[model samples]
Target chain A: MEVTEDIIREVEKGNRKITLDLYHYSFNVLMSSAVRYKNHKEDQMEIVNNAFVKIVKNIKTYRPGTAYFSWIKTIVKRELIDDFRKNKKYKELFKIRDSDSVQESVVEPEVYESMDSESALQMLNVLPPATKLVFNLYAIEGYKSKEIVEELNISYETVKWHIKQARKKLKSLIIENKISLKQ
Target chain B: MKEEKDHIDDFFKERSEQSSFEVPDSFLDDINSKLDVLDQKKKRRGGFFWLWTLIPIGLIMMYVLWPEDIEINKTKPIVSLENQETNAEGALMDSMDEQKSESILISDSLTEENITQEKPLNDTENRSAEKLKSLKNVLQDDVKKIDKLADENNPLWLKEEIKKQEVFNSSNSNNESEIVPPEVEEMAIADSNPEKNIETRNSNINATENAEIEGSETDFAIDENVNNVVVSVDSLGNSESEDSIINNEAFEIDSVQIDSLPTETEDQDSTLNVEEVDPSETMLAGGNREKGDKINHEIQLYGGVLNSSSNLILSNDSSTFPMNTMESNLWSASFGVMYRAKIKQLDLGAGLSWMKTGEKANYGTNTLEMAEVDSLIFIGWQTDSVFNQNTETWSIDSIPLYDTTTVTTYTNDSIFYNTANKYTWISIPLRFGYRIDVNEFSFIPRVGIDLSFATGSNTGTYAEIINEGLTQNSSSRFILSYALQLEVRRSFDRWHVFVNPYFRTNVTPVISSAIQIRRYNSWGINAGIGFKLK
Candidate 1:
């Protein structure tokens, strides 16, 4: 959805409800990202607040041609990555691998689809930040593992491995919860 | 397989679509309140920064208002009374001169009369009578002059002068009248003759008065001029016969005068004597009086007891037990204040502390009972030697080794064996000890008994499965036992670091059965640093 000038003006003029509505939208996006990428709630809130502040400050820079949602998504992604780097948790997720094909079988669609979105997100939150980021990009966002590698400055195989591990943990959680599913 | 894959995909997609996440209510309120507080703090910071600037000014005002130097003045009175007595003595001497002139005139008139009477030789008897009367008049004039001087001046001074005159007169009288001595004897003998007796009595009275005056003067000089008068009196007593006669008269006169004036002089002398006596006695008494003060100020007594033990040590042993094993290291510390009594250089104190040791060993051989079981041993070993830098490193190779033999053989070739193993006991050390202080540092060496309690049991046993006959199972048995230990600690301020190498022996045998297990006594070293609370 386009963030119209009217909405921007209303937010900047301190319209409480309008500002809260805008904030709520951004908060949801950031909270989703935090749940999908950071294990510690305290650290996730930090990532979310950082993304929200950037969005609030730079929202005026939103141009006509650019997709606003994609722009917002990009900001959230970048913030999450920055949070990972700042905390030095990124290294814990990715390891050096010689072959990209070695990690291909690790990520399974059934594991991701087996649980409800909220449950899957909660499971994702438990993953190391970099691994969760790689899993979100490769599996949920449907980005190619190589594209994820480029976006995150990581090896293609590391992206594949993170997706595989993320799916495996999600599968374990599903089994532990004993949630009935169609499969 | 394709149908199953499609079904699984459908199942997950459907579940994902139904899931939703909601923010907790408390979280939103907490965030809003935090933001409000942050804004308030930001606003107040401006005022707070300005307020902080006044702190240094306030401190400067306090410094200026503080009191400056304090002044104290104390005064005391001065005492001395030597000038008053000298003035009184000078006034008495002037009165004596007036009396002496009158006596001289009387004597001169008597001599003139005697000459006039001698010219009328026709009345010879009257001339003799006149001569005797003139002689009597001369003697009476002399007596009058002496009495006037004695009454005017200090009696002691007058008596001294008269004794000298009497010595002179006696010699002259002896020369002029060879019979004077005989006559004087006859006068003394003629008690019936009232006139002669009266003359004798007057002479005796004069001599006694002189003696009394002399005694009083000597006593006064002895009391007032201690060193000089004592020397003079000694010399006078040692002088020749004539001098002795004079001194004897003076002494007689002094004694008489002293007796007569006892009411005034003795009372004053006694008062002065008492005053002088008390201060000298107080000085001597004060010398010993400070002993209580010295004891109160000079002695300080402090004492405490400290116990320190090593927390952990690691060791490896084989043969009797498992072939490879690891042990944990443990240490403990306890400190307590002791009632300390210190006299001069010696210090004495008593204190109590607690200690504990945990250790375990595993045998490689699997027994029939343990054949299907897998076990892991968590070994904790601690020694007091950790604080000792000079302690010889216990070579891992030097640890005592023991062997075990199978007591029972089974059909499966499994054998049961027992081996001896020794473990250190946990100790609570109570020490009554002392330390010598050298400079600011103290070197303490203490001797105390370690009251060790059996905390845990350690036993080593060798065993094999009955079916595995060819496979010999060697096991070491461990049973917990208690022993005594001795420890020494060196302390610094609140931190005490020490190393204790202890000897521990098993109080009970490893195996109670037929096969005697050769148990090795375990000797370990431990060291640790501890803090004192009191």
Candidate 2:
């Protein structure tokens, strides 16, 4: 069902019944954003629920005529990051430099043609959590490096370094998968 | 290279957006249930705020209403003595009046009879009577001096004077009774009921002689005095044979009591000294004050780190957990306020603490085979009566329904998730401890029971039962646990600092859900500052 202005108004007024409808409407977008940070479906579901809880709590602050999907996506991403920060092990990995060197050889564009999103996501998991998060925010989510730096509270050099490490790891994974597929 | 990068980024973004996954039917129900829980938590938070606010007020009211200890010191003993006298004076005066009336009755009867059979004996009896009268005067003077010394708060001097008076009273009464003339005894026996007159005189004399003993020994003295009186009566060779036999028995009992007097006097002396302290006097003012009398309240503020490990046990024997399930120990922190009261070497206390404890679990992916049960409805033929308008008769028709049950098996791959399950609780611990002091430091070993309320929890992954579709977690709001600790403390005037090492475990499993039961056991150390409220 399409969401209208009247539904948004009722939801903003703490109508929990309408808020559930909103949950169903935005389930896909929330799941996709949650999956970038969490590897498990259960944790992703948890992140989505937490995001809806925030959206319902602060719906009144949303400006009308703005893109509602973008607004909800921002809330979901924030929830994902918050959940990630709860794990101290992941937080510690955010500062460590990846020891594996990036091979300078570039992959042919045809190599990526048959690769699906599930395999790509699995390949992305090989990178450290901080590098994966930075790459997803910058390369896929279209967030600028400066915006990433401000959100993550990291220096520009650190942001560039993580993206570089993420690219190298993804390239290595793609080449390995191609070789295995050929075999 | 730049063009290839753009194409690669665009392809990855498109694949991610196009990727689709199915949501389970139970997913919506789970979200709604979580929303309801969040709503309830919001309401409870408001109630908890007011509850927390009222707790300190209730404590203050208890402190205000506590009974105060009364102090009795050397300079203030007169005040304490006055209180005792004011409470006991009416009872004492009433008993004294009864004794005086009875004694006067016996004396009047005795004075009416004059024995003039032997002049020298009469002279000796007269001199002895004068001596008895002089002794009575001395007893009365001693009583007056006791009252005066008691008003002056001189317990030592008063105690010595009482001992001197009792010795004189005891020895004089014995000598005076033995010297009574034979004619006087004959006059006593010539009364209408000789036994009754003799018994009355004996009781009167004993009351006067044992006045001090009665005041100190109470019921014990009464038995001894009765026996002594009966012994004197037996010496008279009364006409009644039964009375003579009874007096002989009394003489034997009196002899035993007379022999036990010195041992009994030492015991009674100790009792008298304790009675002098008076129950109304506080320990601080009493000469036998101890360390416990100095402090009434000790408040401690503390913080500590807990290394918690969770043990998960299967809830049912139907299925065992998968081999890949793993948990790692997690670290959390707690802080609390504790109030204790010291009585001698024992410390009793209760405290409120907020603590977080949980573990990180990794449930790796696996192929799970689940069984589902489904019911199928079939239409069965049955006979039914139908009304026929024309024939006015019933016809049989067939209509039927039956249920059939079937089980279906499905194999699916379980999702992998690593969850850091954190649970927060507000705990109230009731503690008991014994303090042992060594040099400048005190070591206190304590044990306690904690009543904890689960304020909230953050959890993502759960161990699920194969066919039941159930997850393991706690649904109950309260958890009970036991704790043991030892505190090493160093004192600085009214303030002190301490480091406490402690171990705590849930008495019962804290988490019992569909799949498994979980118990949390933790080891921790806390350091805190304490202040005495005296």
Candidate 3:
């Protein structure tokens, strides 16, 4: 379902019915941002639902004619960051590990090309917590090393190293599986 | 290798854009439940917020509308008597020395009607005035005895004075008369015996000296009481006979004129000019009063130069350098206006400032090598023929054997240049300051955070590698900093001049550009003037 201005207006006017419709429509976008960092589906759902509640509460701050998806994505990212800061267990995941170097052999292009997004995501999930987050930000979210440095307060070399490590692990995961039938 | 990396990044970026995972059916239900709880909490919080906000406002309104009549009779009457002692010729001697003592005698019947029109007494004030009236009667009786004693022709005055004291004692025992001031009672007792009157007068002088030492508050009260009696007489019509002075105009106090009769003479005609005393000034004359108002708000304008210390991050990759400018000097400057509102001893303030930090710096020297092309080299010797004008025959003379050849020589030179690099920031500082005052000077210490935004910037020359066509790029547009400040202020009436010395440092780098990252911590002294707003 597409979100119309009428539905947005209804949600802003405290209509719970239209709010549910808006939630279902924007669910996939919210989940996409929440899914990368959280390991459990329940925690991912929590971050998305909290972000949705914030969007509904502060709906008046939403400027018209701007990209609604970008705004929603920003909120979801902020919710993820807040979760990271509050949860002390995330500190263990953020510790920089002495990762092995990338192998000399590169994975053939056909293997990556034939890979389904579900399998690709599974391959990406196998990377270390920090490496997975850095790769998602650098490749999927299109963030520069400098922006990642500012966001994570990490060194430029650390961000570059994580990206390299994530690529190496994902390539190895793909080579181990070779080509699999689409589920 | 770069292309291979780009390929995987492109694939993931596309996948992330095109793919959407299935959301569980219960996700929407969960959001609805949270939304309902949030709505309930918001409603409760909104109600509480209004309730809390209106309470103080309601209290303030009630206080503002309350009546002023509750403050009735709070201030006492202000009065000062210039006692006039008249001689036999009736010339009034306007000297305090001529008066017998500083002790004031209150009239026995100074009621609401007996007061002057300028100061009308309420019913409560009149009750206290009437109590003072009873004391006046005792003083009046004593004045009569003194007047009778002044008759030196009566050689039997001593016997008559004794007989009157006995009568006064009998009246005091019978009617229970109002208590007279101790000094007045002593005067009456001393005058009864003419032989020891001089010795008793010396004792009264000693008592006056004791009153002065005790403090001025007592002196002010006694002076005002005595002036009230004179004012009461003046309120009525001035007359020669004691009866006319008592029975003249608006109100009558019994025997009020008898107290004035000692100074009254037949030839005296000048009426006393009543001096109105200010109660507030009289209280200050005691020198023991609290200050009336404290300054609650102030706005100051200040500006100064500072010495800055900064760490610069430079990159070696000259191709993709974001910022082309770097500052070599450490001098910076800033100026701004601030407004402070005091809550008791602590003050909270916010200010807007413009701070400039970077300066022109030398980029580097550029050396260029060029080949010098114009050179003649000797290769081999050759004969040259020359003809003499007089010989008419061809003659060959060897001037010099030379051949033209190309030779390359290198020239080395360097060109030096500097670029103007400046960074301007519009900053807002929120601070908590405490003021300590000593005499006319005050020292205030402040600590707070500063939030700044880079509004303007220009590129400067830096290092040996110069990238052409690259503009200045600010790494971070916003920066948070902290500062410590101490203000030394000298007050002059409503306006004050102050010198504020401060130290500030950015929590994050203000400019985190690719080539050069600059973060500045500076110390500065600012001087300016401020006015008391309230």
Per-residue lDDT of candidate 2, residues B1-534 (tens digit): 445556666766777787775565666777888778777776787799789757854774565455444221121111111111221221122123234322222222112012222234466778655554554344335434434544555345334434443443444456645544443343223222323432333343344434443422211111221222111111111122111101122222111011112343332221111113233332222133332244357889999899998866765555645522577888999999888888778988887899988888786645455443545567576577999999999898775544434455667766666777788888888899999988769999999999888875434356565433325465347889999999999998889999999999987777776566777899999999998775
Q: Report the lDDT tens digits of candidate 1 across residue range A59-165.
A: 56777456766677788778876766675555655774434222212224555444556665565566555656776766555566545665667765576566656
Q: In model 1, what is the error at residue A72, expressed in angstroms?
A: 2.5
Order of models, best lDDT first: 2, 3, 1
Q: Which ranges of candidate 1 are over 4 A from the true structure?
A: A13-16, A63-68, A96-114, A126-129, A168-183, B1-19, B23-534
Mark the 10 consecutive residues where model 1 chain B has the least summed lDDT: B226-235
Residues B1-534, candidate 1: write the lDDT tens digits.
Answer: 223323333443344334444655644554455445544664687677566445534543443353432110011111111111221222222123333222222222223333443465456756654764565455446444544554565556445434443543465456744444554344324333433332343344334333333322211121122111110111112112111000111221111011122343232221111112222322322122322111000111122222222122112322233222322222332332222233333433332233333233233343332111212333433233333347755423222222222133222233433332233333333333345666545444444444443323443332322222212212223333333333345556655554545444444443332222322234454454544322
RMSD of each: 33.0, 25.1, 22.4
TM-score of each: 0.26, 0.39, 0.40
**Alpha-carbon runs more than 4 Å astray in model 2:** A1-183, B1-45, B60-287, B291-295, B316-319, B323-325, B367-416, B465-475
TM-score of chain B of each: 0.23, 0.46, 0.36
Over A1-183, each residue of candidate 3 has an lDDT whose tens digit, in order, gives 555567668777778888887787788888877766676888988999999999898777677667888889888877876776675675466666775566633666776777777776677777777788889888988776666766776776677778878877777777777734532
* Chain A TM-score, prediction 3: 0.86
Q: DockQ score for model 1, please?
A: 0.06
For DockQ, the strongest prediction is 3
